[model samples]
Target: MIEEIQEQVAYYNARSQEYDEWFYRIGRYDRGLELNQCWFNEVDVLKSALQDIGEVNSILELACGTGIWTQELLKIGKEITALDASSEMIAINRKKLNDTKIVSYHQVDLFSWQPSKQYDLVFFSFWLSHVPPTQVDDFLAKVYRAVRPSGRVFIIDSCFEPSSTAKDHFFENENEIHQRRKLNNGQEYQIFKIYYQPNVLIDKLTQVGFQASVKQTNNYFIYAEGKKINKL
Candidate 1:
């Protein structure tokens, strides 16, 4: 599993240039690279996850592709450590947020890297879905450790409904995911085949000692927030 993830990372790194161009070109529309806000959930969902955070002195955005959510962190006046596995993605993000003082960018694997300091808010936007099911436990453990006492980890990613009759409801199979990809963006990039199962993720978070729950967003993404159990 580790090797598979590493291979996927290498592939993404190699195609970083192409991906950069592709997204930048798409920036012309609301969904484009001009900013990654459109890909995010509605303002209300973002607000809900952030409401209790009040103000953060420092925040960590793991696997922060192109730093879209990192920008949102900045709006709330939090200094951000935007970490990505692909150096090319970090480079593209840096190009967009040229101010280095506020946004400290790092290119490192989330599975192995350990933070020297805890953050008030640790966020992974549309990232958990990419992680393989077998490795999710370890991933959740790391996320649990990165956050400060009473701080929370916010995950917003793809989720499917079990009995939704909607046409583009939740993905139950590869075909549905492919259809979603085509509908959202005409790209068929499935570097690593992944699927989202909401209840399963919540259960894993519980096992890792987090207080977890899920929120259905925009009838598309699943937003889960987990709070690290702090020692009093």
Candidate 2:
């Protein structure tokens, strides 16, 4: 399991250059006119949800990949702490943001990384799904501690829709938690790719003492909002 996790990191490091293609719906991810449009429409929904949260003084972004969502978080966060396991991904994020003084970049595996301080908001996009099932409780527990009292934690992750991924990648049974992802060069790597229903995610959040709600956009994305329960 540890070795496969390392492979997952290597895959992302190698894929850093082409990672935007998936978000842009270019290359193998292009699914023709209607489906591609639908994908963008749902993406817009997620964007609006983030904007609706308004602004915060500090934010912590986990698995901050390639600055795709970091750019969005920038609009609402005055100070952002971005962390990722892949140095290559962090490099791209820094370059894309032009090493903005408002953002602090750190390269660390999510499982091993600890929060040095809490923040007004905790955000991650397309990240929760990558967490293995066994580690999810521990993962969300980390998210819980990363937020301040009544602070918000927002999540954006993928649904199990086939069209949401590259055409070359195949979806296994819904019950399975692993998937094989292929880079453009035809190199494939196995990684934990767990999909979640809205209710299930909400339950997970609530179990960790968050007052949470989750919603989905048709067949593409599941986004969630949770507030750390104020015990004080």
Candidate 3:
């Protein structure tokens, strides 16, 4: 497990250059124009949901990646602190932002990460799937502590749809917690990937003191929002 986690970090670091292509439905990730359009349409839905949560004064983003979500977050967050395990990912994110007046970057492993201070909103995109199944409880506990009471925790992750990945990759077995992913250059890596049903994620959040709700977009993505409400 330790070795696999390290490999996952290395995989993201190596794939950082082409990561945007995956999100944009370019290269091997394209599944024809209709499917590509559907992907973008759902992406808009996720973006809208993030924006609809309203503006926040302090925001913390985990596994922020190449600023795809960071750009949207900039509009709503008064101040932002972004964290990622890969320095390469952070480098791409910094370059894409082009300016950093409202943001700061930290390269840290999420598995062993601790929040120095809480925030009004904690957001992570396509990161929940990378949490190992055995470590999810501990990870959610960290998130529960990362947000202030009544603060929100929003998450975005991929569904089990095989088409969500590159055309050359084989995705199967929803019950499996591991996935083999191939980069554009044809290098492959085994990473932790656990797909969750809406109810399962909701229950996971609830276990750590969050009032949670989850939604799945057709066959592409699952997005969720949770609030940490103090119990009377």
Candidate 4:
């Protein structure tokens, strides 16, 4: 499993350049632009999840590829620790931000990287999908330990439950993508799958001792919220 995960990370790291080009080649500068727009459209849903958070003093964003939320957190005056498993992505983030004081970028595996201090808020945007369901319990426990009492956790992900639209989009056919990649050594590769469901993720979070809930809309990705319970 570890090897599989590492392989995925290394594959992504190797594609940062091509991925960057692909993102803009078709006039979609941000691959997540649609997702971000959907998020803003449903910002109220996110705000409700974060209502208890009075002031976000310190934040940790896991799998913060290219500082998407990093910019938003900085705009709100929160100190951020942005981390990702891909060094190439981190390099892109660093170059984009120019090593600003408010943003600290780290290249580390989320599962093994231990936090030096607890944070006021912990967020994972479009990250849980990359994690296989079996390891979710351990990941949640780590996240619960990383937040202070009353701290909140936010996650934005996709639903595994099939939708009519998604079915037509990708599920309706298996040969949705036919593009192939050939490495310099002549090895060939193709993307398999890159999506997940909300219920599976929420159940895993609850099993790990969190109070989790989900919010869904046509405009955005599935939104899940959990709060760390204070020990009595």
Question: TM-score, each model?
Answer: 0.73, 0.97, 0.98, 0.72
Q: What is the lDDT of residue 179 in candidate 4?
A: 23
Task: Write model 3 residue lDDT over 1-232, tens digit each, in one string.
Answer: 8999999998999999999999998899989999999999999999999999998999999999999999999999999999999999999999999968898999998999988899999999889899988899999989989999889999999999988888998876988999888987789899998899999999999999999999999889999999998866
- State in Å the error of residue 189, model 3: 0.8
Candidate achieving higher lDDT, 1 or 3: 3
Clashes of each: 3, 0, 0, 4
True-structure lDDT of candidate 1: 0.66
Candidate 1 colliding pairs: 26-32, 27-33, 160-170
Better of 1 and 2 by lDDT: 2
Candidate 2: which pairs clash?
A: none
What digit string (tens of lDDT, one per residue) describes model 2 on residues 59-125?
Answer: 9999999999999999999999999999999999999999999999988889888888999999998
Q: List model 4 lDDT by residue over 1-232, tens digit each.
A: 6666666676667766555443232222233556445445665565454554456888888998876556656654368888898888888877778778888878888868777778878888767766655666787788888888877788876433332121122343322322234433344444323354567657777776678787775644577778777765
The clash number for model 2 is 0
lDDT of 1 at 57: 82
Distance (Å) between predicted and true CA of 155, model 3?
0.4
Give residue 204's error in model 4 in angstroms.
2.3
Comparing 1 with 4 on TM-score, the higher-scoring candidate is: 1
Error of 2 at 78 (Å): 0.4
Tens digits of per-residue lDDT for model 1, 1-232: 6676776676566655555333232422233332335333354566556665667787899987775566667776458888999988788778767756888888888767777788888888766766766667888888888888878888876545332222233446642322222123333323444556678768888888789887766544677888888644
> CA shift at 207, candidate 3, in angstroms?
0.8
Residue 177's lDDT in candidate 2: 84
